[model samples]
Target chain A: MSDFMEQFAELRDQKRFQDIVDAIPYARLMGVELGEDESGELLFSLPFHERNVGNTVLPALHGGLIGGFLENAAMIHLIWNRESLDTPKIVDFSLDYLRSGRPKTLYASCEITKQGKRVAHVLIEAWQEDRSKPVAVARAHFLLATTS
Target chain B: MIATPVNPKVFEPMGQLFVSLPHCATLGFQYLGADGRKPVLKVDWREDLVGNPATGVVHGGIITSLVDTTSAVAVTAHLERFETIATLDLRIDYLKAATPGKAIYCRAECYRLASQVAFTRAVCYHDNPDDPIAHGVATFMRESSPLPMLQEPKA
Candidate 1:
């Protein structure tokens, strides 16, 4: 069987990828860019702007907004893999805030922890400026549309 | 048993089952559409709720919560009585920045309900409901246990 990364590359070239990206609301807000690395991993990035901040007084981004952004990133990765704009139902999600997302662009990457026929588990990490230092981490479980 | 608050002036019965929940308690959630098979909840904008200061844009989280809560309200309309609900999953697509300083509203409906789950669809707009600024679909799980305080005392 072809690996997920290889399939991802083939799907990106098919031009079906943009539709998946455009369907996400947070993607429009943050202006996301979806790309693939040499290893076939999906790369999602957004430029951090002043508007993303929760308290302009503190100049810190809201945790909820951060959650929304990361959730969209992970969801898009799943859609890209499946090659469909229809999304799986999110069963549950939990996020741990490591640090404040500040005045810089943000990048996120995700890995499928458990890919079940009914449920898919994913782990996502987000950071700004430096990849080595992660700002937040999330674990999400999605219930597939076809699953009973 | 502790009594649930009931004020006659506010609690006008919408039907045999539903009460028109107080909009004042909901904060700018007034603008209800005409009574019909599926009633709509409206939200008119006020300056205080903006999420970003630079453009006076309402925060995405506020919109998300509005969708979640209003969806639950629609579900409550169908219920025999109050039941607790927990958000299962919610997804929203931001179409474009809403026009600043203009009153925006939301139309939320609960379209699907299973034994354990309720599914909802909602659109947020300004002035015109036809033109939507954000669209959302979410699933909410009903809570099984009643609060201890609300439990009836054994005779």
Candidate 2:
């Protein structure tokens, strides 16, 4: 087995999932965190910081930051749920901004809509304060390839 | 939310506003002056922004932010004033990963400016516009009046 495959096997231990997520530089820079909710679903959260604010006028979080957080969340979710050594690549991403992202703790959850041998579709919803009122929703398609 | 006419000179101070933004500053986005018709923005390569540590390639999210910010600036330039704007939706297609150690440039144009909405298209590239790294389409809700914000305080 290759070195990466060996590492992938170790990462499958579940306890190391958060470590893998934290290794992403962008996620670390944004202060993104990984946790589990009441039902044990993976959860991603971003703590409010001045560097994440896009509009000083509205004092709202940058829309791009919100999108980035969701995308990273989906990628991490995929990695944790699948037995893959290869990193997933984003084919395309679309975001709908339902409301402004207030500068506060933001949470995101991803649901895999479809998964194939070589492709996966994910829907992500980001919310703050209330889950019913999502601040933004996104759809992403990824090219998935795993080494056995 | 109120709409009002704004002075065209507001464009001059807009660059300062963008740089003053915390996110823009963190990303090191430089507001290059307008390129004849549209505004251009650039972000130099940095390690902290890399998505794949093994490859040193910048994250797609950085490009997304560049495209979104460029689109917002294009809409403001089209209106020729600084009014409050919020992104309604943005769609981006990644053509290729950005080459490491190269600065990325983005140019955007506001194709339509309705009474309450503005539409924009943008391209992000490293060296040649013909070979774009990503293309984006975005819509923003334009507030009628500019918020009561002043220029940045002197350093």
Candidate 3:
């Protein structure tokens, strides 16, 4: 393992979590932000940006961007919930677009439905305004990185 | 209303329309013509799009976006009109991590286009079509009619 990764494993949960998020280049390009809800669950948000728009007619956010946000949320959720320092590899991803994502700030949350020795399943939901009315939802299966 | 048969000529301009989107432009997506009725798109590998810094592999999210956008283009090609369409669902299976520093190509065909829904299947590859990096299936909700009012006035 690299010295940086070893040091990451030694850091506290909060710093380690931040490092993981920071390490993903795509997440930074999309300007994805991470925070926590009142219940201590991780919350992900993508601030409104013109570069996120896919359809100029409806001015809708790109479907892929929404999917990426949910996937990133799941990844962060997995890292935050687990103790491993290795990054998870995505096995498969499925997303259902519940509604057209407007060009506005979007929020997301993830739930780990199942965690096994070698794999993990996550459900993620992304919304714009109302939490109940999600713009998109997704399920992802990830192969956990083996600890040394 | 009887469904109109879309003219193949409509694809060129429609593909241009897709690449005009800000997000698509930001990701350097290009409309790489087509194969038959299917529309093909390409995104060259770049440092900013890497997911695994250690391996320099493109993120799965970028692949998802590429497939989703290519599928949408296929739907437009099937319709032969710039009707508003929203992705209803998209499922992508990553067969392997994308080869670093190689441009990725995606092609999709709208196999079924009903009044309200369009179904598409897509594949992403790096040098050979036979060996795909990812396979995707998606469904899109098609608006019954064009909503011209929602469109930005052409500058």
Candidate 4:
């Protein structure tokens, strides 16, 4: 990890992290809260429920929601790194579905693949329980405001 | 819901009309709720068409499709006609996983819409309404086509 990334991990570990997501009303609506492990790793999980119902035949998850989860994961990871949201606006993002997220709670982790001065690139994966396996994967290109 | 067939001239932008799914044309989408310019849609997560990997968890592609489609829905809600809709950009944030046991419910809202593009926000929640498993924001470009086309899938 770079020195700046290392510093971010340190600050987040101390639990002084605060951002608009902490105060956003929808944060509670979406059941998304920020938590870090002792080793400074970030984890996001979503449990199964009734409201997610699609149909009696498939009973599958929505692709839009999966994309939402990935985007949030990437954004939160950026915030965790102490990057300003205004510095980056999503240029584009894409997701590939590998398999269905099983009936267990979904877990995700994101890595800042490349944090350039004008743009930041991120990669994220989501799966159920097992970190080694992934249900969906996504990449994000965030354009820094300073560049334009 | 209008059941007008899409014109081939406009549909040509998306290459071919792959799936003639009734859901997009006949049943159509109902605008349920919204906050300001943001509009929410209550869509049924069907198992047969959407898929069931295990017992209850729905496929993540459905959610991605919903977000992409709804961005257009927001545009349609404002424009009231099916033109070409292309996703300029999209980002999803996964919160809690999803409730695999039941259907996935979502409320997608469009927050900002301009001449070049429209901005949308959304959340997918199941079991508990207070918590959402996923959330998203996307930008869409209105084209003179049949439906919205997202960038080719990225795995």
Model 1 ranges with Cα > 4 A deviation: A1-19, A83-86, B1-155
True contacts kept of 2: 0.64
**Clash pairs of candidate 2?**
B3-B144
- What is model 2's DockQ versus the real complex? 0.61
Per-candidate DockQ values are 0.05, 0.61, 0.65, 0.08
Comparing candidate 2 with candidate 3, which one achieves the higher DockQ? 3
Q: How many backbone clashes does candidate 3 have?
A: 0
lDDT of 2 by residue, A3-39 (tens): 5334545765756655766567887888888888899
lDDT of 4: 0.54
lDDT of 1 by residue, A110-145 (tens): 988888777888899999888889887877777765
Tens digits of per-residue lDDT for model 3, B1-155: 52332765555677877877888899999998877778889999999898777778898889999999999888877764456778899999999889999999998989999989999999999988789999999999888326641343365
Best prediction by DockQ: 3
Chain A TM value for model 1:
0.80
Query: Which has the greatest lDDT?
Result: 3
In candidate 1, the residue pairs with backbone N, CA or C atoms under 3 Å apart (3 or more residues apart, or in different chains) clash, namely A25-B93, A25-B94
Fnat by candidate, in order: 0.03, 0.64, 0.76, 0.15
Residue B46 shift from truth in candidate 2, angstroms: 0.8
Candidate 4 runs further than 4 Å off: A1-22, A25-27, A83-87, A146-148, B1-66, B69-155
Q: How much RMSD separates candidate 1 from the native structure?
A: 13.2
Model 4 Cα lDDT, one tens digit per residue, A1-148: 2343344455666674443233322223334456665677777665664333221123444444556667667766776775453423455567765655455577777899998877889998888866677788889876656443
TM-score of each: 0.47, 0.90, 0.90, 0.47
